[model samples]
Target: MTWRRALSVALALALALLLLLVVYDRPLRLMPWRKRSAQPEAAERRTNRGPALATLGRGKGDGVDLFKGEPLLGEEHIFFVETSCALDKPQHVPYDSESGLRLSPRGACAVEAAAAAHPTHRVYLVHTCDVHRRSLAKDAAPAYALAALSIPNVRLWAVPYALHFVGTPLQGWLASGALRASRWPVVHASDVLRFLLLWKYGGTYLDLDVLMLRSLGEKKNFGCAESPAAVSVGAFNFALDDPGRRVANACIAELLDYRPDLWSYNGPGAITRALKKVCDVQEVLEMTEEMCGGFRLLSTSTFYAIPWQNWNLFFTEESSEEIMMMIGKNLAVHVWNALSHNTTIYTSSEQPYAQIARRVCPNVVAAVGDTM
Candidate 1:
């Protein structure tokens, strides 16, 4: 009787094991523990990888990196320049705009959106401040993990570190006898890097201060007009291997030979000057909404609805609803931090900046303990 009972138990166990193996060998997984982590695995991959090597213009002589695999250039990308202070932690905390770019709260939201916006496209936040940057606040790296989320499509490109041992396009300009570092602000470095990225890797370049309310729809090669006919360099995109890259190349060349003429000499001014020759339009105001030399020209109302001079309206405004309604057909809005840096983003009560900040970078706001 005892031997029969033990044989029965062994047979039952063998049957269960055979059934499990058969189920697993079929279509569906037999065990829940064996389920694959698709999203988390992809996010992990994104954290490790950097930008796809720009193959078109950046030949061996142009200083392209040797090891990084050239991901398809046809793949879409959204690039942002953030030369942030290393100590600026808790990225959502409100610091003086005059201090630097909105690296925390605003930047966190912008990067999150840009990465998630185009599900397939890659987003690069170029941290170009290698060493010379001054620390404005405390450690923001921990809080940044929240903003960055497990964004599989986003990459934080530390420019100097990435190109440390490799040859880069900028080395020529840096090595040139005429180049002077004295006149260049670290901010100007942003401009130089922006132009270089656009020229090398065909994609859109956005300012860290800009925010997008929607995904970057269908990608195209284009620049937004700040006013009626004046194009702003703040938001622009290009198709891979587009001829428009030449315009960016010319701008970088001018940036190499830069002088402090106009405040925006290295930025908008350089872009406008290049477009004037290519667009063949004598009056910038005369430039229409249509394509200019195979490039889409977006109007200010479609992008920069508020002028830089009127930046105060964003802060003092009483109602967030009224301001949102006024955004109209804009693809995105430029915060114009350069003018509004000193303006307070928070107030005793609900202010426009706070409302916007809460909606976009909620994680940051919560981390910083901002009153809702």
Candidate 2:
């Protein structure tokens, strides 16, 4: 009697376990397993079956893919164009945007100066920002556009800016990664910009926060400003001219393709991934910190030094004044104070006011020049 009862209980337990496993199989597949999915691969084929731009950044309808298939990193124009093209939409206009379509006078001036300074170089205003400033009303943006039109050498490109909702799939993917988990969304965006720029322009990537004290064309080699090894490359401030572009582009492409997941939240990982592809990257690093794109202040000789407070200075200061000063002297400041996003350029003297920037960088002053 006892044997029969025990056998029956064991059979029931086995059946229950089998049922549970079957129920969870599909859900487990939904998780990020090492195995590849047949779905995304198949979908990619279906969606991309027709003729497509050789790259994802450059979409159709933006005129000829003159830069198509040809590497993007070395050519500044292609970089700007491709990035602008990828981000350019007719303006979807997000709901929470506080500022509308307005460009600060200071911002306009900088664009003008950039264009005039580099007439042959194809200067562009690559704006990765959102919509809905009371200042940026429909009427206002047009005025900004008009001002931009008047600027001799500059063109403007914009993305309908919005906060990266942490709950979204992309953000979630980033947060889940081991390498990317430490960084904020802004870092992710900055890295994305790097890939975009490297893929598109490859010459030099300026963090939007940078004030552009002067033209960076003079720097011949890879310009890497100084920060810590962890934060140094600044990816934004970094510059990769003609040859480096090819290396960076191939490296970035490989990283994106091989570990698209790493691109999710890991800025440094993306950079690391790119660096791994090049054999002589160190020689390139030796050229100029300015080209490397960190906090190398623009001067007669490019030196390696932290801009002001990008990495750790902010942590020490009770007030943000020091940071503001850094923002002022440096063309861009990493405004990564927020937990979830990277720092945006201090275009205005609003809260987190870059008063020092107002004083030193005329371009910064000019962008917000109209502000009192």
Candidate 3:
């Protein structure tokens, strides 16, 4: 009778302990070795929560730690620069109030397509904002940015001009407010920053409007020709330590004499001028390695498959199949957002742009829905 009473008391105490553990939300491990088994459950919870935004980094003098704790920048880095500070009020695409300071649906699709195409590369979406001041909370960030950030290899960063341009020749030009003198300050600023970014980082820099169709693969130190005589600055790659960075160095140096009145002069014109200094501009049509001192000039079809003159073809239902076939072999397709900004994209429509968005950046397409 005494032994039976003792056993009952022990059972009652165990039940109370189990109840307390449940109330406190602590798992009860009956065996100490089972603690190791719980690790998988914890890991699964983290996996379900998705990756945290990789915007955390300390700004060093003259340069930035783009991704503080992540892997270092190697050849596997792809860059997309967003110079527009009016992200919340996008001028090009339909604005959604719920998205909060995110890129337009089209812009986000460009980035997500790049990330999805090259899963191994760390795709960085760098914004030209003052990094020290602007830190976007997860809930407050727009859906496009959040959706892009959800990709495992994608990272978002806000870069300050002072930090990024410190050691370069553009430092003086920027400090003197020469950039403000431009008729199109934002466009000109984008031109200046792209040159500086490539010179300093030596990786691929893509415009927010360019959609990726394939991996760039070992191709470095190259630019796609927008025409027989002009090189498109929208998509270009240069190595950081490529023995003096001839083209990049030349472009940065030319920016000091930047002309504000002429629109394309500072953007496409700058690269065209730089290539001339390195190699014969006429040879660019041949795309020979020796033509530009080992710089490969890709054909226009590689990027600008749909010429700006026919930019509306992307939106027109009639040109959808023709445009798709044109860009089938190309590495990417430039949506020509500059000309197509006013053109509306009907999600339900069979336009090539909408179809590409659905195929490449489905997450963004789904998030924005029929509004895009």
Candidate closest to the true structure, highest lDDT: 3
The residue ranges of model 1 lying beyond 4 angstroms of the native Cα positions read 1-72, 84-102, 130-146, 161-170, 177-184, 288-291, 347-349
Pick the winner on lDDT between candidates 2 and 3: 3
CA error at residue 337 for candidate 1, angstroms: 1.5
Tens-place lDDT per residue, model 2, 54-136, is 11111233221111112223334412321221222422232112333334433443344445445555454454553332334
lDDT: the better of candidates 1 and 3: 3
Q: How high is the CA lDDT of each candidate model?
A: 0.57, 0.39, 0.70
Looking at candidate 1, what is the lDDT of residue 37?
35
lDDT of 3 by residue, 88-206 (tens): 22233333333234467788888899999999888877765433223333234456556776677776655344455655677788788776677777687788878877786688889
Which structure is stronger by lDDT: 1 or 2?
1
> Each model's TM-score?
0.67, 0.44, 0.76
**Candidate 3 deviant stretches above 4 angstroms:** 1-75, 86-102, 130-135, 241-244, 280-287
Please write out the lDDT profile of model 1 over residues 202-297, one tens digit for every residue: 788888778766666875767777865456788887555444665666566667656544457777777776677666666566554352556767
